[model samples]
Target: MPTIYLSPSLQPFNKYLTTGDEQYWMNLIADDMVPLLEQNGITVKRNTPGTTLGQAIRESNAGNYDLHLALHSNAGPVNLAGKLRGPDVYYYPYSSAGKRAAEIIADNLRKIYPDPDLVSTVATTKLAEITKTSAPAVLVEIAYHDNPQDEAWIRNNIPLIAQNLAMSVCEYLGQNCAL
Candidate 1:
């Protein structure tokens, strides 16, 4: 079975504009993905709540994982608050495998995100999760939590989001999964 390190956001302080925090929503999606991941013949290893990103990176690097998937919701900058929507799947600029994984995730995410045109795969040299792990990594900013419409969309579609994410992972792992 292909093993994946599933790191959901640990930032409970990044509250959504509506009623929840990034940590809460990200973990809910991660929690839901676990069973589906296992059923699809993938081994899932995840970071615990309250752990730091450094700790999660260390744990993932110590493991023999095929991929490292970090789940998070986005927030717009101060001046741009509530103006952005859609997912941004990020990967290290120099890693081909990471870029491919990120592209696959972004494409799959477009199937569910409100505007397919808004879903993008971003390449960056920063972001510890994308640079420090042993496995190919993709940190997906699932949606803009600071936007009311996006927050409402996320709150109402947890199951669909989870299933879509799981399908994305399965596809990345070369496993067949129907949405």
Candidate 2:
């Protein structure tokens, strides 16, 4: 079976606009995705909560996994906080596989997000989640948690978002198992 390193955000300090923190919500999504992945023939190696970002990266690096998927919710910079919205799936600029994963994830996200045009694949050189992992990686910022509308969307649609993401992960693994 294909294995993936599922690294949800470790940042509890990043709070959502309404009721939860990024760590809490991202983990909730990861929680929902695990069973779907397993049923589809994918093995999941997930990061432990309360661990540091460095630790999560090291755990993922130590594994012989096919992909590293980092789950997160966005929060814009000070001036733009509560303003920006949408999902940004980030991949390492030069890693074709990473880019492909990002595209697949973003494409599926677009189908469920209110503003399809806002979902995008971003190539980056800075984020350690994608750059430092051993496997081809894509870090998905599911939506802007700081934005009211986006926060409400996340709060209300956890199951739908989880299902969509699990489907994307399955597609990335070449499993595409409809379970």
Of the candidates shown, which would achieve the greatest TM-score relative to the real structure?
2
**lDDT score at residue 6, model 2, on the 0-100 scale:** 94
For all candidates in order, the CA lDDT equals 0.92, 0.92
Consecutive 10-residue window with the lowest summed lDDT within model 2: 170-179
Tell me model 1's lDDT, rounded to 2 decimals: 0.92
lDDT of 2 by residue, 72-171 (tens): 9998999998889999999999999999899999999999999999999999999999899989999999999999999999888988998998999888
lDDT of 2 at 47: 91
Worst 10 residues of 1 by lDDT: 170-179
Residue pairs in collision within model 2: none
The residue-by-residue lDDT of candidate 1 on 152-175, one tens digit each, is 988899989999889988988898
